[model samples]
Target chain A: MYVYLYDTFISEAKFQNTIARVETRLTDLGIAGKICRLSVLTSIEELVNDAVKNGAETIVAVGNDETVSKVIPLIADHKVSFGIIPIGKPSRLAQLLGIPEGDKACDVLSARVVTKLDLGKANQHYFLSRLEIPAGEYEIQLNGQYTARSLNPNQTITIYNFDSLAPGVVADRSNPRDGQLELIFSGGESAGLGRFFNKDSATESVFPIKKAQIQGLNQDQSVIADGYTIINTPVNVGVARSRLKMIVGKSRGF
Target chain B: MFTKDEKNSSESETIIGPSVQVEGNFNGEGNIIVEGQVSGSLKTKGDLRIGTNAKIKADIEARNIFNAGEIRGSTVIAKDKIELTKTAKVNSNVKASVISIEAGAIINGKVNMSQEAAEESQPLELQDKKEKNNRK
Candidate 1:
């Protein structure tokens, strides 16, 4: 059975209309499910826990990127599958999953094409997109053996769990399920002869790493996970061993 | 910093700014343009352009490398060619099939131009071990 967790922040009219459309489609498709609305008083974790306790076969999120990110870790390790019925603004996660916006997303969910995708962990929190730390000097230890120091003190470091979310930022390689994270370092301002001679002076360094430890923070830096600021500097980021079973569109890019 | 258009370039070209300094392992498939300071190892499938004011101390591998900056430490191996501009100040060994040095470029190390240079430019033991572990 599927349990739909709808975000309460959406407009009442649109929310009700979406629920009705989703129910109609599920009924027409002969899929079993129940709809639950998320409120300020109730936490997403609690709602997900309740769904699991009730033996929900699939937990569907009906909101935007933040909502999906919040629900991911709660159900990732479970045997149950996760689905998304995107509402409101377009999301990077939805785009990567190939889930269409509006009522059409319901159709994709109904298709029930499930794929196992890797999850990234920043300390205790899990993120599906990417994590960004402000530009700074850092000592990075990759996959236990390789250790490197940031030569540029103002370079921004980003760890990507999904390559599509990075858009034009290209790396040497990107395989989300390969149990590795894509680390990108970008920053600095070009000056001197480079500005006068080389029009393309901006540079970026990319690495495909499994585990990384960033040290030498000044305590003012913030770590942003999936577009949300979560923790301070000096954090541990890596790909989690557990995978998330997601219902994606037929032409999805994971 | 990258302009709005360069940041969104579909070619996946990378640009590092002049004021920044980075030390780590960088591997990329597209072109890279550095205008700052970079230490450690850099490997790219496409061209690598080091700006005139840049200072890099690392082993590098790329299809083609255009250096107008200062490079030291390990050898730079280019599969296709290596170009040293007038402002280029290099203090490391270089191995490339083709090498071009403009007037005023300073070199403090050996330059090897031969097919055998490819085999001699293999990554250091640490990088080789890391690659082996990645394959496993």
Candidate 2:
């Protein structure tokens, strides 16, 4: 199967750099001939139309969170599989997808295993991070640094260094049957500095939501979906079961 | 506050090496130098220097921007100064309060300074606003 590479962000030169690196890596892995790229499509609609017309089976989105967000909704309606190569800052979605930074990203492009993963929806849009309804603003001290900001409702919050809590948090909140959104409120003076500091699941949230429909969240609420901001308030969020066909890293284990 | 071995090591001034990447946004105030790769937005209140081989793809808000390497995104420098050295290669829009392009430096995109700032906002800046507006 041929892999279609898409560079949707600005800066064509950087896109060229990404293409060069991707091509080189694919060549090293003996798959260069299977890749094709179509950049500068004027708009996202054109980009997707071109991809479908090109007869591409899989789409590898290069760049960061914003780029991934642009394509997720489009591919969800189709049968094409999608992958990501994180090359921008705040690549929360890419980090969640298990993509490495820099040159190692090329290696990820070459290695692919397909799997079905859960997706979240807020109104008409799809999200890939933890959703926060009644979106409370919180600050986190990351790697000894502090980030003070309010989180938006229906946004995806990517959790790092909180691996122990991921499963419990996801299980309690994310429910395909109930159609509810999952949420976990956490953070402190430092990364891993939590209420359960002594316990193994200190940083994890045991609460899960199978289905949740929130109302009265204001009309203009802001949300961070995999680091991409969406400010559509008073929106309905629910779990979309097996909504995404992902070209995951071999070690992702679904 | 330096020992004998530490003093000797400082004298050689081994650069901050290369290939290392910072994957998150950063902010600071000082004469900082980056030698490897930085993949995020940076906001500095003082001089921001990029080393000869560094690769930075960021939306930078800083003072006294000096580049001797490659920048793949937009730069917004609010006053102080800006210098693109002989080996610099910038591929995107640059909106500086001040700018200096040395011999051999290459920029493939538009250069937006005090004059062009009104005409064009940086790509990353526009993207930020768009996302913010979408939330509204």
Candidate 3:
């Protein structure tokens, strides 16, 4: 069974046409199943659990990256295949998965090219992308063997699972299916004036880690996972190897 | 399965770039490339490469070493070859199966050329004590 999850933001007037087109396409392909529109009062855990209990073999996120983030960990935990239909802005996950926008995504999902991806677990939350932390007086312990800390505090410590920051600086260096994460210490510097600046990073180091403990030395710090979700410092990170069976396009960027 | 996009990247699993400084015991099984600064002890089962800009103060061990950096350490042991480039400067007792030193490379302390000599050589502290006795 296929259950399509729609985010609350998808109800805006801008996405009405897009939602209709996707539904029509899914029906046309005879692959349409239950549709669950997530609202403010909806319990995401209950909704996903109910879908799984009702025999949803595949859970597809019908909105943007936020929608995928909320649902992917659930379906992955339930051992169900996942898909994405990126509708609007802020859909970098779909882009990395090579799923096109709107109704075009339905065709790729119908092709059913499923691939396994590793999920990064930071404490309780599951993250598909990397985890970012400001490198400021922090101690990074990798595999509990050695500890690494930066002499310069004005940098970022990014632990990548599904390497989406494909800039040429640290390009094509991280692989999610390798059962290891790339812990990168880098500083992002912006060049240019005003809002037209571009962020360039010179990667300081790369460490392949199976387990990591990031602790702050000066004060408590913030750790951002997949961009928006923030976890406090002293975070324990481990790789959940091949945790997600995701439908991806042939042209997907890793 | 999706076709993978192949791009050239560093073959070394561990890379210490030019902008960071690492301390304490750092060891790994894979190849290591150091371009920055390191202190304490560094060891790897695979090959090690040090760039010209690197400054290292540690006990180092690897299968092979290609160094062009500046090292102030107690000992450096390589199971295979050790190549010190023209820009390299070492202040450590070094042992390897094969050793090559280019012009302008400065090497301090004793150098053991063969892997068999590693088993025959005395411990670092014992050698130091022997040298002191000879001076006396």
Candidate 4:
């Protein structure tokens, strides 16, 4: 059975209209499911747990990137497969998953093509996209054996679980399911005539690590994971042991 | 003379400009050009070019290395070749399959061009090693 989780933050009128259209489409496609609304009192974890107890085989999120991020860790190691029907602006995760917005997303749900993907964890929270760290000097210990230090305060560190985030930055070694995280450090000024002309040129250094400990930060530094500020500096980031079974559109690219 | 063709033939995947300073372990798969200062180790599958103004204080391993700057400490190992321009001032052990040094370049360490050097320049399999050994 498929259970739909709808975000209640959207306007009630628009939410009802969207659900009406989506339900009609699902009915036409012969897909049976129940839609559950998320509110202040009902936490996402509670709703997911209830759905699982009531025999929900697939839990589809009908909201934006935040909704998807909230639902991933809840259903990560469970037997239920996850789906998405993006409904808000800035639905980059939906686009990355190749799920169309609105009524088309219903078709994707009905199609039900599933694949396993890796999840990145910082502390207790899980993220499917990437983490953006501000420019700073950091001491990185990789897999407990190799240690590296970054002295440039202008360099930005990014840890990616998948290749969906950071457009134009080419990561040739990024594989989402390969059980490794890609760490990219980019900084420096433009060279020669470009610098004279005020061009933005920088250097990018890439590394593939299984587990990393990042130190050398002030206590107040915040780390942004999936567009949300989750924790402060001196954090540990790595690929989770569990994989997420995700339903994607046919054109889904890693 | 290093021709323009030689400089532009292989595009650098990563470029470090003159104003930046990096002190970390860098591992990647693309060619890199460093015009700034790096104080740690660098590992890449592609070629590495140290520009004339670059100052390096780390061990480096790459497929090919073209140096025209100042390097100190550790060893510079390349699988294919290591070329030092006239402005290059290197003060470390050098190892490669082929080594070329300009007449005006200053070198203050041993240079080894042999098959063993080429094998040592290959990508390290650190994931399988049991003990921690720093490359100095």
Candidate 5:
């Protein structure tokens, strides 16, 4: 199948060399010479233009999920299958697809099988992840560092914490019934608890939800989706119903 | 059904740094650690980790989401575990076989722990449902 490669040429000195190497490998694999257009982009607008102009039946996004995120909206309505040769820092979607690291992605692309999947919505915008509100008066230490705490809602006031700042305060408002969006909230106990204790709290309030109407938050709040951040708040996210056609390799048997 | 031993086994843990942000659906089969923010849906057969500063706003379908951070939206599928640490905060509905919440964790949402088939393992049920609907 003819494919278009959307390569995000990160201008970092090291990345320039890395991009060259990837191009060389593509040539060695015989993909560069035939069946693939290594579409390189320096800007989002250029990325869209190049992709539209290439007119390749399949789009093999060759960066991390962030790069793919840029193209998702462009291709959401178009009939195109997406393939990923993930080489970026973290390719969550690629990892999920079991697309191997480095050059091995060639094999994944070669053996990929197209399957239509559901897409999510965030306030009229189509995305893999929806909008989010931070926890109430919460502080967490990850990788031994404290960050993004100021944005968090203060939980000392129980009402503000539970009513306005919690993750799923909008379940009823952002329902996931259409079968695309999967609303999520993150609060529970640590992993070390025994099975019984875990069950109790999980059964209590604050697990996760399908839809909701969150209160007391807006665009100022940050949300993380797919692997991209800086999402506007007061966001309403849901499923887009039938929207994406993904090309999963044979190993997954999708 | 194939035995556990027959399945491909890998043990590399991926870390999504706090600076990174992903905005799309994610489905995978290996262990994932999220320190950054994620929006959209996540589904994996392996373990999932949410870093302290990480924020996610979407549906989650994974074997487990070891929460040390924050999440919002719905948890459509978590077959194994959904652990929330003291610093964890989540406000959303959850559908999981197992879940854990720590003393300081703040959670405000509904959680359903009904015994249900894993999404991938429900092919037979789906086929049957389709057949039944056709008959109807």
Candidate 6:
């Protein structure tokens, strides 16, 4: 059974046509199921719990990255296959998954090209992308053995599960299925004209880690997950679940 | 059912780019390329490349080492080979199966090759006995 969870913003009148077209296409493909709108009255956890109890084998997020990130932990816990029908703009997760926007996403979901991916968990929140934290405020201890700190205090340290967080940034070393995360430390000093002067300076440093602890976070420093949620530190992050089954298109970026 | 582009092949390699300073023991299971400052120690089971702009002050161990930087440490051990490029300035006791030093590279410490080190690893009393037997 497929149960679609639409984000609250989709309830606006501007998205009516897109939602209708998506439903029509889903019905035509014989993959249509119950659709639930996210609202302030009903909590997402309760809805997901009910869907699981009602025999929802596949839980699909019919919204954006924030919507998908919210339900990832529940889907992984229930051990159900997940799908996404990206609708609105800034659908970076869908772009990375190779799923097109609007009704076209229904085709990818119906095709059922499932792949298991690792999820990055910081504290309790599960994130599919990466964790970007301000550098020098924290020290990351990798695999509980060695520790790494920023030599430069003004940079940002990003622990990437999927490497495509920053578009056109193109640091392609992180593999989501390998059960390890890539800790990328890039100094902001080499941004505009500094790159010209520092010809020999390396722009990025990559570290592969199985487990890590971000310690020494102050009250002001926050770990941003997927560019939306502010995950508080000190953070304990690793592969919370290594086998998150999802429907992915052929052109998906791993 | 999905076949994403597998263009990026997996390489177990670490890059310590320039303008970064790393302290403590930096250990890896694969190849490592250093272009920065590593103060404590650097060890890897695979090949190690010290880039031209790198300034490392750490004891090093690896399978094969290619140094083109500055290393001021105690010991550098390589299981297979060690190649010092023209810009390398090393101050450590180096040991390897095979060693290559390029022009303009400066070495300020003792170097022990595989053959002499193999003989030196034997018990001293046994080595003296062997020397006596060889004289006869």
Candidate 6 local lDDT, A1-254, one digit each (tens): 99999999998899999999999999999999998888999899999999999999999998888888788867777778999998787688888888888999899988899988998888888888888885547777877766666666656788888856463233467777888888876765656887789754435667777788987656666788877788777889888646688899887887
Greater-TM-score candidate between 4 and 5: 4
Model 1 residue A149 CA deviation in Å: 8.4
Q: Higher lDDT: candidate 3 or 4?
A: 3
Candidate 3 residue spans exceeding 4 A from truth: A188-203, A218-220, B1-9, B115-136
Q: For model 2, how does the per-residue alpha-carbon lDDT over A1-254 read when each residue is reduced to its tens digit?
A: 44544554534564567567766776787655343344554666666666777777777776676777777877877787787767656565555556675457667766776667667776677765554433343333222221222222222233221122254334223333333333443322223554245221122211223333333433455554544546355445556777777765544422
Per-residue error at A237 for model 6, in Å? 1.4
For residues B40-123, could you state the per-residue lDDT of candidate 5 as single tens digits? 776678888776777889788888778888889865467877788888988888777777888999878887775454444557
Rank the candidate models, highest DockQ first. Answer: 6, 3, 1, 4, 5, 2
Give the lDDT of residue B79 in candidate 5.
Answer: 81
Model 2, residue A207: C-alpha shift (Å): 4.1
Best by lDDT: 3
Of the two candidates 3 and 5, the one with more favorable TM-score, higher being better, is 3
Better of 4 and 6 by DockQ: 6
Candidate 3 chain B has its poorest 10 consecutive residues by lDDT at B1-10
DockQ for each of the predicted structures, in order?
A: 0.17, 0.01, 0.37, 0.14, 0.03, 0.42
State which docking tier applies to candidate 1. incorrect
Query: What's the C-alpha lDDT at position B119 in model 5?
Result: 47
Models ranked on lDDT = 3, 6, 4, 1, 2, 5
| Chain A TM per candidate, in order of listing | 0.88, 0.65, 0.91, 0.88, 0.63, 0.92
Who wins the TM-score comparison? Answer: 6
* Model 5 root-mean-square deviation: 17.0
**Per-residue lDDT for B16-125 in model 6, tens only?**
66766677788889877777788888898988888888888889999999999999999999999999998999999999988899999999999988987689889999
CAPRI docking class of candidate 3: acceptable
Q: Fraction of true contacts kept, per model?
A: 0.26, 0.00, 0.62, 0.13, 0.00, 0.55
